[model samples]
Target: MKLLIYDHDGQLVELEDVSAKTLMLGIRDAGLNLTAQCGGCASCGTCHVYVDNAWQAKLKPPSELEDAMLDVVEERRESSRLSCQIELTKDLDGLTVTLAPGSAFE
Candidate 1:
């Protein structure tokens, strides 16, 4: 499985064999700045990302907690998702997401 992330700088970072790790960790570890203010606790919308529409059906529906958090994000969209709430797995191979403007850690 691979994960593709569009960073704040508009550069794409790719991670191979993405499994177990959450999207937030993968983004940060790839040297991209994503503000996980609550550290993957779903308490903050800082880790928000816009999951590509093509891949929306591949992911599990967001939980109630995640919905509440996303509701507070000004950039919320139909594709919006909390990076911390998505875990990487083989099923998500080729997953791609764009960091929401307001969620950049830097």
Candidate 2:
């Protein structure tokens, strides 16, 4: 349950063995404000974050709905993924993700 968060302020923090919350929830619980406008249904892009290069390939690819939703995200990138769509798991212990500026809830 480790989390590598790239904060909106350009800082990276490594959080270890967090609970099984959705990535968005975990980020919020960790004291970061990430927007989940559509809840965790994968319908909104406000929760978008760019997963680190080394960990991207290890994640499950986005669903077609997620892919479509990502188009609305500001600064969308090849590694962009909706945090709400990401479920915490043991295999994601070292996951690194970059929080897009202006993407999280202000």
lDDT of 1 by residue, 1-106 (tens): 7888888778888877655488888877776788889988899889999999899999999999999999999779999999999988777888999999889865
Evaluated against the true structure, the overall lDDT of model 2 is 0.83
The reply for model 2, stretches above 4 Å from the true place, is none
Could you tell me every candidate's TM-score relative to the true structure? 0.91, 0.91
Candidate 2 lDDT over 1-106, as tens digits, reads 6898989888888777689578888887787777777778987678889998998888899999999998887878899999988888778887889888657676
Clashes per model (N, Cα, C within 3 A):
0, 0
Candidate 2 local Cα displacement, residue 37, angstroms: 1.8
Question: What are the Cα lDDT values of the candidates?
Answer: 0.87, 0.83
- lDDT (0-100) at residue 88 of candidate 2? 83
For model 1 the TM-score comes to 0.91
Model 1: residues >4 Å from true position, as ranges?
none
The candidate maximizing lDDT is: 1
